[model samples]
Target: MAQSHRFWNWIARRYARMPIRDQASYREKLDRTQAVLQSDWDVLEFGCGTGTTALEHAPHVAEIRGIDSAPKMIEICRERAAAAGCANASFDLAAIDRLDQPDSSLDAVLGMSILHLVDDRDAVIANVFRMLRPGGAFISSTICLEGQARLFRQVILPIGNFLGVLPRIHAFSRTNLIAAFEAAGYEIEENWQPDEDPMKAVFVIARKPA
Candidate 1:
């Protein structure tokens, strides 16, 4: 995990300048996520790289605390937030499991393009569930590597990770991903694929029962 953090730090500048490949799909996700947010709600976003999503949703919520394990990522995030004059948005360097929030304290939690990178998806989901207030939402977008080319998943991805070119990747299916949330006691409010790619991007909005 330390090495992974360092790797992200080394690439932070380049990562921040990388363009969004699918703007339309990203906009749709932002719109859907914003729809469930209230101006009085407090939100948390894990793996919030460069703080783009958090800043985007800042105006819709009372406050947003975005965290990433990578210190440099959090640094860039904080810089962006300051540049944008987003008083309600803040960034911190921390892992998901290390968040120092009380249980049932947050009004919402966001995870975008993060689920597939973590080693323990269930633990992350459980933490998110523990943090949210009843009726709060977990809005996320994930790259499901299940549909990726067999050679890439079985060969290239592992090689890339070994070479420090990529972080860990977990392959997950849409059905099982939804099942994980349901098993964690969240009711699926919405789930869909935003783009038609071999390795698809999935968006979900799940609510904790009130």
Candidate 2:
């Protein structure tokens, strides 16, 4: 985790400068997410790299706290928030498991392009479930490699990681992701794959039962 943090910190600026692959589709996802957010709600976003998504949704909520393990990422996030004049959004350097918020305190939790990188998906989901108020939402976009050829995902991705060509990936199927949410006591409000590409990114909006 330390090594990962250092790497991300070193690349924070470059990562921020990179262009979104599908701007139109990404905008659509943001719009859909913002549409469901309430102005009085308090939101938390884990693995919020550079705080882009949180900043985007900041205007729709009363407060948004974006957390990332990388200090430089959080620094960049703060810089961006300042540039955007987003008073309601803040960034912190913290791990998901280390979050100290009270149980049932948040109105929503968000994770975008992050679920697939976590080492313990179930534990993370459980924590997120614990943090939300009843009827709160867990909104996310996850990159799933489960649709790829088993040999390539299982063997090639590992080799790529060893070669430093790719970051370690925790391949998850869309079905399993939804099941994980349900197992954590969330009701699936929406779930769908946004792209037909082999990377298989999935968007999900799940609500805790009131």
Candidate 3:
């Protein structure tokens, strides 16, 4: 975890400057998430690098807390939140597994491009589930690396992470991901893949039973 933090902190500047790889898809996600969000909702967005998504959703919700393990990432998030005058948004240097949000408290929790990088995705998912209120949403956009590039997941990614070129990645199928969510007692409200490619990000909005 320390190594991952250092790697991200080292690259924080370049990461902040980099443009979104899929602007259209990003917009669509924002729109979809906004559709389900109420004005009085309290939300959490873990792995919120630079606070873009949380800040974007701030105007729609009462409060949005963004957390990341990297100190530099949280610093950038604070700067961006301040520049945007987002009083309802907050940023913190924390990981989802270590977060102690009261059970059934948050209205929504967002995990964008993050679950795959975690050391224990199921535990994180369970923690997120515990934090949300009944009928609350757990929205995520994850890169399922199980398909298309089998060799990349089995070989290249592990080698890259060992060589300090990539962050820790867990390769699993979309089926496996959905199964985990269902096992955690979430009701799948939305499951979408932007394209036919299996390697593309899968957007999900899983709701806790009300």
* Global lDDT scores for all candidate models: 0.88, 0.87, 0.91
For 10-75, candidate 1 gives per-residue lDDT tens digits of 789999999998899999999999889999999999999898889999999999999999989999
Count of backbone clashes for each model?
0, 0, 0
Q: Where does candidate 3 stray beyond 4 Å?
A: 1-3
Clashing pairs in model 1, backbone N/Cα/C closer than 3 A: none
Question: What lDDT does candidate 1 reach at residue 54?
Answer: 93
Order the numbered candidates by TM-score, best leading.
3, 1, 2
Residue 93 Cα positional deviation in candidate 2, in Å, after optimal superposition: 0.3
Worst 10 residues of 3 by lDDT: 1-10
Candidate 2 has its poorest 10 consecutive residues by lDDT at: 1-10
2 or 3: which has the higher lDDT?
Answer: 3
Q: What is the lDDT of residue 78 in candidate 1?
A: 90
Ranking by lDDT: 3, 1, 2
Q: How much does each candidate deviate from the true structure in C-alpha RMSD? A: 1.3, 1.8, 1.1
> Best candidate per lDDT, number?
3
